[model samples]
Each structure stands twice: as C-alpha cells, then as structure tokens.
Target: MALFGKALLIWLMILLLAIANGILRESVLLIVVVKTAAFIVSGLLLCLCIFIMTYLALPWFGRLPASHYWRIGALWLVLTLAFEFVLGAVIQGHSWAQLSEPYTFKDGNLWTLVLCVTFTSPYLAARLRFKQGSKFL
Candidate 1:
C-alpha cells in the first residue's frame, strides 16, 4: 500500500513536471485532466485485451500459473508497446530504420519505468485501503 501511494505520488510529480515544462514552453501540454481521461479510456480497452490474451496464451508460454494479474499486465504493456510502434509506422508510412534520427532509448526506458511505478503504487495503496476500511455507503 505504501508503495502504491508512492507510485501515485511519483506519477503526479511527473505530471507536475510536465506542467512546469508546458509553462516554460508556453505551448499546449497534456495536462492532468487530459492524461486522466486518456488513461481511463485507453486503460480499460488495454486491460480487456490483455486479460483475454493472458489466459489464451498461458499454456503456450510454458507456465501453469500465468493467470497472475501482474504478469498479464506486464505482457500487456509489452504487447501494447510493440503494437503502437507498428501501428504508428504503418499509418504514417515511415519505419524506424528509415526515419531515424538521434534518439535516446534510455530516456524512453526511464519514463516507462516511472509510469509503471506510479500507476501500480497508487493502485496498490487503494486496494490495501479498501481491504482495511468499512463501507462508506
């Protein structure tokens, strides 16, 4: 639960940083509202797909306990990452190899780590809190 809270705080911090960056740049930024909306919508769809895929491919992955939520989530992320990369390339008609420029894979990796930490931490905290608390209704 503590980890979850920390994760959420981290996510919020990242968003705050983005907000500050937007202020400095004086341009449009994906603010918290937009980010939240996008996450809710996209996350629902992604979760459904990942849930289905996880159960379906569990046997093939050579594991008996692949039904675990976190494993499915990790796989979902990996799949989505690849899927988006392909979709973007196909739609724009530009392959990574062709439109290559100076890019830092490390930066992307770091941000992805931050996202995972933040999203999961808040979620874990909420889950733990729910387990301990009484009904509000």
Candidate 2:
C-alpha cells in the first residue's frame, strides 16, 4: 500500500481501538466508581496502545516521501479532530459547545493530551531509526 493508504488504515485501526477503549473505560468506571482514576488509567492504556501500534505498523507503510512524517501527522490530526466532532455531535447528541469543551484544557479535560499524542506518534515513528534488537521505548 501507499503511504497515505497505510496511514489511513492505521488511523482507522486507532479509531476502532479508541471506541472499544471508551466502552471498556465506561464499564470499568461503573464498577470501580472513581472517575479521576479511571480516566487516567484509560488514557494511559489508550496511549500505550497507540505507541505499540505505531511502532509495529509504521515500517509496514514502506517508503514514503521525504516530508511524509509531517504530512501524515497533519492529516491525521485534522481527520481525528473532525471525527471527534462529528461523532460527538451526531452520535452522542452533544452540542457544538459541549463538544468544544474537550479541546479547551481549562475545563479539566485531558482530551487535548490524547490529541497531542495521536498527532505526534506518526511523526515520532517516522523520525526514529529503529535498530536490531532495540526496545520500543
């Protein structure tokens, strides 16, 4: 597959994983009843998943343009933000204002962190020079 195609596939996989994480996070929270802890744990879990996914998947995308890192990262950021807004407004029935809160960190939402990690993961993976017998971290 081409670079953009590979990147799109990776993004879709991440989206599916994120959806599953949301469901699992909600279920766990219901049982544990600690919002803050649940949020932190789930966020970390998702971030770790993204890290592992990018580590394993980026090389599979094959040769890319010299600017692939920045291009893919920017594209992913735009797509993700749009997906979030559309999903929130259409599926979750959240108002535009309500959905906007997540982007505003002042409201105590850690979603911006999620966005940062997502936006940077591809670029980081593309920039790193993997070596034989090297650890992902």
For each candidate in turn, the TM-score is: 0.32, 0.82
lDDT of 1 by residue, 1-137 (tens): 34334323433443454345435323332343454443343334333332333333333333222233344344434543554467558777777864342123321223344335433432333344346652310
Candidate 2 local lDDT, 19-102, one digit each (tens): 888898888754685776677777777887776787678668664554776687777789889898888898899987898876
Instruction: Indicate the worst ten consecutive residues by lDDT in candidate 2.
Output: 128-137
Global lDDT for candidate 2?
A: 0.74
Error of 2 at 24 (Å): 1.3
Q: List the lowest-lDDT window of 10 residues for candidate 1.
A: 101-110
Residue 80 displacement in candidate 2 (angstroms) = 1.1
Highest lDDT: give the candidate number.
2
